[model samples]
Structure formats: structure tokens, C-alpha cells
Target: MKQNLDLAPVGNCSVSALIDRCGRYVWACAPRVDGDPVFSALMDGDDPEHGFWEVCLADLKDVEQAYIKNTPVLRTVLTDTNGSAVEIIDFAPRHHKHHRTYRPVAFGRIIRPISGAPRICVRLRPSADWGARRAEATSGSNHIRYHCTDLTLRLTTDCPVSHILEERTFRLETPLAFFLGPDEGYDQEVGPGVAATLDRTVVYWKDWVRTLYIPLDFQDAVIRAAITLKLCAYEETGAIVAAMTTSVPEFPESGRNWDYRFCWIRDAYYTVRALNRLGAVDILENYLVYLRNLVDNSAGGHIQPVYGVGLEADLSERIVDSVEGYRGMKPVRVGNQAHEHLQHDVYGQIVLPLVQSFYDQRLIRPGSVEDFCALEAVGDRAYALHDQPDAGLWEFRTIARVHTYSSVMCWAACDRLAKAADALGLADRAEVWSQRADTIRARVEAEAYIPEEGRFGASFGGRELDASLLQLVDLGFLDPMDPRQVATFNAIERDLKKGPYLFRYVEPDDFGEPETAFNFCTFWFIEALHLNGRTAEAREIFEQMLSRRTHAGLLSEDIALGTDELWGNYPQTYSLVGIINCAVLLSRSWTDVR
Candidate 1:
């Protein structure tokens, strides 16, 4: 089978996994989101026998998969040639318990025979050391323990241990429940406990969805996007991952893959903003705590573009050669090297999200003057480096230029800090920041704008076009109808747009020119089209983008322009944020209900 992104994700914000169409647990990390990939089949392209957990139906004929309603719970039904079928319901247990939310680093699977008697084989193979070796197994009467170098996982199931250990085929007689968790004994009956956990998990998701203020139109799409974005968040530390799995190339053999399992300030800001639009303030509140820690730790110094979920700073990149990459591509990388690059927009991304805490009265602990004072230090760096060259938001590995988008973000930092100062009755600080914003705006207009081309260049005195320029209006840097902004948008569309998708840029970077269209940029184009009064065209393009989503109504970082194939990491938070943002932008007004 060709490697594809036709997968669904299940998690409780603590740990997550990717399940393929055939109900195999293809990828999951142990201990935490950034931990070892105990189930590493997603990255093991050459040898698929190990590093995965699957239930194989004898003589399999057809397979069907879908998420249960509003939850991340996935249900896959496999039908055999003889009409025997079985339903595999998979979810990670998450609900309220004791005095707090009970989300464990565990997976729950309930196997139910829904039709004729089905004979199935259980294949539970997990690897350690990045697929260098299969996990050693020890079995008991009802459970089996898989031991890896750094982690040990226990599979507590009601099924016969012999059938699982021997990978023996057996006739389905009754439902079976499996709980894969820490190396501990099961306190409750496996079947009953898992069933109860499933019930509560469903209720928990449904109740959470009820709290969202979604748009009237595309409610289903919006909810799914919202839930997927929520799943990307690591609640333990309030850091949101960019995507689930790593080393999934942007395009086949393109070598454009980068590990996105850690938290990027830019990506998390977008995720938190999208959820905040849905009135989901809890995520924002928790993320604020994470941000505060980052700010406090930095003490107004340099901040990396990305960090580990636990706020670890040194993310030195290394290649894991044991496992073949997606589709046998080499060099499955672990840590991201972007941490060392000077992505100046991070200064603004940090401050932009903090602006909400000062203005929003709903937060339990609203921003105080102390918070504003600390953020001013970030604003100082933004002002000082607004014109300096660094790796832009795209993180071009081999080049450095004073990108307009980065400068615009720096301007936003100062501008928002001015507003926050005004809100706090600090007139002196407000004037200081306002002056800094004006100075950056003047420099950007003078250097980034091309008078002959009647548009803003991607960088100072450069003529290249970038999709990030389309955010001129979104970031409050330019008016939607400004003639310069319009010309820039049209120039970008003429050069970078292919069919219904948009490329981040056409220029070749560290890798050769990007072969796939960026999903987030396409959405930005959709929003721009809408803002420019091309609502009809914008809606048409938005529908086209939506049609390109996977079966689970999710998108990756990049799409093959010619084939409309998702080609990047799985369930990208950036793409999910696009769905929510565009839905809210294009949906009909709620008053239309009358």
C-alpha cells in the first residue's frame, strides 16, 4: 500500500497516536508527546512488520473508518470475504476524576463482533530506539508486557494472552477490551472499565464542544477542526505541537520534511487564537501560563522559534538512521535545528498572544501592570531588531534577509504594547511604544515597498513575492483596499498560486524549490480574497480547499499541487487553524437563521 495521510488521531492532550485506515496504531510516542515513538510504523517505511499494533481479520475484503460524532474517538470496521465483520473502537482515556481532569498516557481499544463470526489475528509489535529493535515481550495469563530501553508498556486485555502473544488467529465469540498503559496492574475489570472510560470520553468531548461559539455554517467542519487543534495541545505544559508525526515529507522524495513534534511560538499562537475565536478560553488560559514561564525564563532575552513541550531549550537536530523515513526516504530527524536560528517574528508572536490577556476581562487572572512591564522588554527587542536580517517565518535554512513579514510582526509587537499601555493608564509607556511602532512602519514602507512594481517586496529592496505578504491586512499593517496591498496580493496570486492552492514562495531555498503548496497559505489567500470583496470567488476557493481535506476532515502542512494529495505532517495545527479561521470568516451570519 502506498504511504498516505489517510489517518485519524486519538488523544487526551497528554499523549496521542495515529491510526491508519486498517485500524493499525501506526505512530504513538510514550511518556509524552515528544518522547520515544514506541509505535513507530509511520516512519518505518521499509520494514512494516514491527513498530505497529494491529488487529488483522482473516480474508479481509473491505474496511471503513470514521470518528465517532464530536469526539476524537475513531471507529474502524473490517469486513471479511465471508461477511464476518468486526468494529474496532479506539480512543485515549480522558475525563474528569478526583479533583482534576484524568488524562493518562494510555490507549483504549474495544473489539466488538458486529456481524457474523470473524476470525482475527492480533499483531502487537512496538519498537524502541527509533525502530532499531523490537520490544521484548513477557506474557501473563491475561496481560502482556513489552519492554523497551527506556519505556515498558503493559497491554491489559480481556482477550486470551496466548492468542495475542502467539499472533494466533481465533474466532470471535464476544467483545474484548484492551488497555495499553504504564507497567502496572489493572485495578478494575478490563472490559467494564474500558467501556465506562469510553462513555465518559464521549461525554467529555461532546460537553466541551457545547461550549464553543462556532459559526452557523460549516458547523461540522469547524467543530472537527476545533477538536483537532485542541488535541495538538499538551495540557501538561500548555504547549501545542505543530503536528503529530515527523519525517512525513512535504512531497515524495523532496527531503522537505522537518520534525514538528515540538512547540513553535508562531504555530501555538495561531492555535490559541483560533480556539479563542471559538470561546474556548481554557486553552488560552493554560497556554498563557506556558507563555508566562517562557517570558519569565527569557527575562527579555532571545527566544527560539520552537522548544520542547516541557520548555527544554536545547533541541539539537540529529538523524535517526535505523528507521526508514516515510516511503523509504532516508534521514528521519529527531530534534529541529530552527531553534538556533534568529526568527525575529517570534518576538511579535509572543507579544501578540499576550495582548489578549490584558484586554479580555473573562480570564480568571487578567493581565496586570506587572505583566505589561515584562512584555515591554520583548517590545524593546522587536524595536531594536525590526530592520535586522534573520531567518524569516518560513525559516529559510541557507539565507537571511530583512523579510517584510518579520518586520511587520515587529511593528505589531510595539503597536499592541502601546494599546496595552493605554489600557493600563500608562500614558508615558503608550507614547514610547506608539513612537516605536511608527518608526518601524516608516522603515518598512521606505525599504520594503517597490515604487516601480507598485507592491511591497518580500524583503527590503528585493523583488521576490511571498504568501506571508498577504497578511499585511490581517496584521493591521495595511488596509484591505490599500492600492499597494492590493497590488502585492495580485502579484503574489499571479506568481505563487497554482489552481486552488498557494505556495509559500517559488524561490528555491535550502531544499530545492518547494514542490507542494502550503495549506496555510491557501487559506490566507482565501481570507484575502474575501476581504477584497471577492466573496464569491473566495467561497469557491474555500470549498475547493475543504474538498481536499482527508477523510477525517483534516489537512497537513503541504498539498501536492498537481494531485491534491496531502504530503506533510499529519493533522497539522496550522492547517486546522486555517479551517476554523476561514469558516468563521466565510460562514453566513447567525441572524440568517430567521
Candidate 2:
């Protein structure tokens, strides 16, 4: 199998693997998503042992892959030219055990011959030290232990161990099960254990999908996006990562590769909003605890834009010199430096999700006066720093500016808090916050808009156009019908539009011109069009965007406007959020469809 971006991800919320269309495991991380790479072929280019696990047929002719209905369990069928075929069922074990979610650090594969005399070979290669060293293996009758410097994985299999050890091709005779996990003995029965795990995992995912409030149109897209977003969440800590893989690059040799395994408060906020629109509250409920921990840890001081999934604070960025990058792109990075940048918009983002807990009675712990007080502390920061120069939402490392988007977000923070305070019957706090919101809004309108150009700029007293200006109406700083906003939208279309997609901005940043269109910004443009009474055009562009997704119905962080190829990290949560948001906005209402 060759390296491809059209891979499907299978995960249990703790760990995940990206399997190519040919049933080869291209990327997987052990222990956690940000942990050491156990299977790193996705980044290592052209190595003989490319740290992959593949079940290859000797005389393969065709391959087909799809999920098992609405579940995350993937099934791939490989057929030889001579009417012989085999089925590979791939999934991570996820089910309930002893009333607790049983998601171990393991990957499960079940191979069953579906047609006549299919011959196959199982190739399992894992690596350590960032793919610089191959793992050593020692086998027994029904198990093989692979030593990977810091950790070891015990592969418990029911196939002939000799065949796997020597990579010999053999005729398909019976079903085989393989479970690669931490060094531990297998359950009582290998076949039954795996079969039961698959059965229960299918049931678990399908049952969860049944609770969604899907739109009348684009139901399939919405469901797939929701499932992908769920897969990105680290359920144990309720921290949702921005994407699955790291350093996939935003462009070809653009050197914009980044590690998105950690949770960004801004990205998580958007993710929760999309899930909430689908009537999925479990994610929001789980994530509240993470926010609470961050608030408590802040000690009423500064807040970082990103953090480890386990709530660890420090994230020092560094490149792995030994490992080759994706498709031979260099400088594969591990950690993110955004954690140290001063992104004041996070104060507003932090409060947006936290405020939802106050009105939603379905949460385990509804917000109280104490909760409001804690939120006020965060809002205070937004109020004080709304005019300060920070990295902005773009995280421009070389320069800092007073971003208009950040100020509007601060206004939204105060505005939402005022509403929540009024709901809780705290009239004084509501009035105070409402006044502050008005003050911030006036400052934004005064400093961020250029009357000569009839458009709002990216920063205060500037004329450069950016895609984020489309969000002013969404933030409630301006009414959708306001002509000023219309001018801003039109100006953005004139300056930043690239065919069907939109550039984040037109000006040169630290890395010169951006190489591709940001996926989420295009979705935001669609929403802006819909809000501005251009529903027909919005629906048309929305369909066009949907058509660009991978065969598995997934989008990466960036898309090449010229070729429409997905770049950047795989299965980006922000892109998935765009799918849900656009589907909900453009789809016909359930009332009409029913």
C-alpha cells in the first residue's frame, strides 16, 4: 500500500490509527495521541520497514473499504484477480466493562476469507525513537512481544506464528484474530473476545449516533462529521485535539507543519458549539470539567491558548531530525509553541463554552452563582485586554497586532455573560457587563473600520482584508442587515477570494503568502452568505465544498485551491466543525422534510 491522504481513522477516544484504503495501518500513537509514535510510516518517507501493519494479498487486484453502517468500525475487502477475496475488519476495542468504558491501548484486526483460496501475508512493523530504530520482536506459539525502547507491545494472534514471523504467503483457510496491545496476556478466548469486542463496539457507536438531531438535508455529511469530531475527543480528560496526525504540512514544502495533538481552547469551543447544535451534550458536559481545571489553575491570572489533553501546561516545540516528514517533507515537529503565545481571544473562547452550562439543565452540574463568579474573572481579562496587541487568532509568530476579531470576541464574551446574569436574576452584574460590551463594541467600530475602503480591516487602523471579518455578524457586533457588514463581506470577497475557496488573508505573514485555503474560513463564508439573504448561492457553494471531501467524507486543515487536494493535518476538528455548521445552516429544516 502507498501513502495516501484518503485514509480512515479508527479510534477508541484514547488512541487512534489512520488506515489507508488498502487496509494498511499508516499512522498510530500509543498510550495517548501525543505519546511516542509506535507506527510512524505516515511521516517516514520510503523506508523499507516503514513502521506499518499491513495484510497484503499475494495477487491483489481490487480493494473496497467502508464503515460498518453508522459506526466507526471499518471493513475492507481485497479481491484477487482470480475470484479469491478476503475481508479485514479494523477497529479499536471500545465497549462497556464493569460499568466503565473499556478502551485499552490496543488495536484489533480480524481477518476472514470471504471467497475461494485467498492467499495473504500479515506484515507488522512498529518503530521507536521517532522511526529511527525498528522494533525487535520475540514470538511464542500464540503471541509476539515487540520491544520498542521505552515500551513494548504484545501481539496476541490466532494465526500460525511462523507465517507472521517469516512473512510467508499462505492459502486462506480459516478466520484469524490479532490484538496488538501493551504487554499483557490475552483473554480466555482470542476469537470470541475479539468478536464480542467488535459486536459491542458497533452497538456502542450506532446507539450513540441515534441520539443526534440531524438536519433534513445533508444527513450523511452531518453524521460523518459528528463521528469524526467525536473521534478527536480524548474522553478521559474531555480535551478535543485539533487533528489526529502531526506535521502533515499546510502546503507542499511550505514549512508550515505543526503538531495539533493538543487541545486549543478556541478550537474546542467551536467543536462544542457544533456538537451542541446537533443535540450532543455529552461532549460539552465532559469538557466543562476541563475548563474548570483550567480556570482553577489560572489562579485568576493569564490563560494559555492551548494545553495538553491531560491538562499539562508546558508544551515546548521541537523537531525530530531523524524522522522524515510526510512524503519526504522535512522538519516533522512534535510539540506546539502556541501554548506560550499571548492569544487574548482565548478569554472570550473560554467563557463561550462555560456559559452554556448555565442554561442547559441537562448537564450533570448546572452553572450556579459561583460558576458565574468564576466566569467573570475570565471575562475581566477579556475586558481589560480587548485593546492590547496579541498574537491574534492567526497566531502570527513574527508580529502582534490589535486584531478587530479579538475585540469583537471580547464584546461577545461580555454580552453573553450579561444575558446569563440576567437569566440568573443578577441585575447589577448584568448591567455592568452590558455596559462593558457596548464600550468594547464602540471601540471596535471606531478603530477597526476604514471609511474610505467601506470595509473593516484585520487590525485596528489598518486596511488589510481578512476572512475573519465575515464573522462580525455571527458575533452580534453588527446586525446581518447592516450595510457596513455587507460592504465588509463584499470587500473580503474581492480581496481574499480564490475561486471557490477563501484565503485566511491576502497579506504576507511570517511565512510569506499562504499556500492554500483554510477550510473553516470557507464554511464561515457560506454562513455569512446565508445570513446575508444569499441562500441560493450559499447552498450552491456548500455543495461544492462537500464534493471536495475525501472518499471517506473527511477534510484536512487546508485545501489547495488550484488542485483541490487536501493538505495539512488529517481529519482536522475545525474542518469537521465546518461540515456540521454548514449542514445545519444550509439543510432544509426537519419540519419541512417530515
Q: Compared to the true structure, candidate 1 yields what TM-score?
A: 0.99
Scored against the true structure, residue 315 in model 1 reaches a CA lDDT of 91
Computed on alpha carbons, the lDDT of every model, listed in order, comes to 0.93, 0.90
TM-score of each: 0.99, 0.98
Per-residue lDDT over 1-594 for candidate 1, one digit per residue giving the tens place of the 0 to 100 score? 556788899999999999988999889997887788998888888458789999999999999999999999999999999999999999999999998999998999999999999999989999888888899999888899999657799999999999988899999889999999989999999999999999999999999999999999989899999998889999999999999988899888888778999999999999999999999999999999889899999988998999999999999999989888888986688989999999999999999999999999999999999999998889999999999999999999889999999999999999999999999999999999999999999999999999998999999989999999998899999999999999999999899999888999999999988888999999999999999999999999999988988888999999996778888888999999999999999999999988
Worst 10 residues of 2 by lDDT: 43-52
**Residue-level lDDT for 114 in candidate 1:** 94
lDDT measured at residue 143 in model 2 versus the true structure, 0 to 100: 96
TM-score of 2: 0.98
Number of clashing pairs per prediction, in order? 0, 0
Best by lDDT: 1
Model 1 ranges with Cα > 4 A deviation: none
